[model samples]
Target: MTGLRPAPARVVLRGRTVVPGVVTGEVLVSPETISGWGGIDPATGTITEARHPLAGVCFTGRILVFPGAKGSSGWSGFFQTTRLLGTAPIGMVFAVTTTKVALGAVVTRVPALADLDDDPVAVLRTGDRIRLDATAGVVELLARTEEEP
Candidate 1:
């Protein structure tokens, strides 16, 4: 799973879903370290003062793959505000689970897949196009080429 290969079949993972948007950009993978409050901007979907290495980057309509939630409980609210502001990820992929992220998922109602055995952050590149099926609990990687619109 580390090396490049043809697009694989949709992988399944059972977890909560968050946000409602179309995953149309390259996959941004982050394993284990994600701060809810600062990781994203509700008004812009851009990564705010999250302190993460990828801070200030935007995730609007992209598939945000991570291990789990981090930082304050206010994380959920941030995502809620982003949804209200029309700036939210199309879906989410988590390697682990947490109460805070779960609540956010329930509120956003976006496609989500969690508890993934394979590290999406490690396997998915920043520009890999992806499709998430929350209802079926599957994530399909399309080829990696140019950045998505």
Candidate 2:
């Protein structure tokens, strides 16, 4: 939906809305959990967790799909910084929700949904475009995409 790309076949997912909103963005899936305080660059939206699989990748403006949060309570703070820096994800789909993830989502003010019928990470692949209607608790995956290498 970003450009002239045609809408592809979609799979509608059901979940519980955390922060209600509608957003369409390229999906960025991560099996690895994020460490908050020292894991990310708020200014650039890049994953900086050392030795992590997604290190150096930028999740900016993407639909960040992951399991849940890790590390300390600093999780919310770092993500909040991302919002202040304008580098937060457009939306998030979590397989499971924690207080940390919920707080972070609200502070970042992004459309977020959790506790899905199926794990979003398993259903969503990186590079798949998703239109998330968090208010309605739906995730629409659009077509196969070139998986990031």
- Candidate 1's TM-score reads 0.78
Deviation (Å) of 11 in candidate 2: 1.1
What lDDT does each candidate get? 0.68, 0.87
TM-score to true structure, per model: 0.78, 0.91
Q: Residue 120, candidate 2: how far off, in angstroms? A: 0.6
Superposed model 2: Cα runs more than 4 Å off: 1-9
Report the C-alpha lDDT of model 2 over 1-149, residue by residue, as the tens digit. 32324445557899999999999878889988888888888999999988888999999999999999998899999999999998999999998789999999999999999999888888887888778999999998765565433
- Best candidate, TM-score-wise? 2
lDDT tens digits, residue span 1-149, model 1: 13344555554333334433344445777644677775676777887664576787787777788777888998788887878888877778777678888887766667777766567776676767776766655566776534332
Candidate 2, residue 16: Cα displacement in angstroms equals 0.3
Backbone clashes (count) for model 2: 0
**Candidate 1: lDDT over CA atoms?**
0.68
Clashes of 1: 4
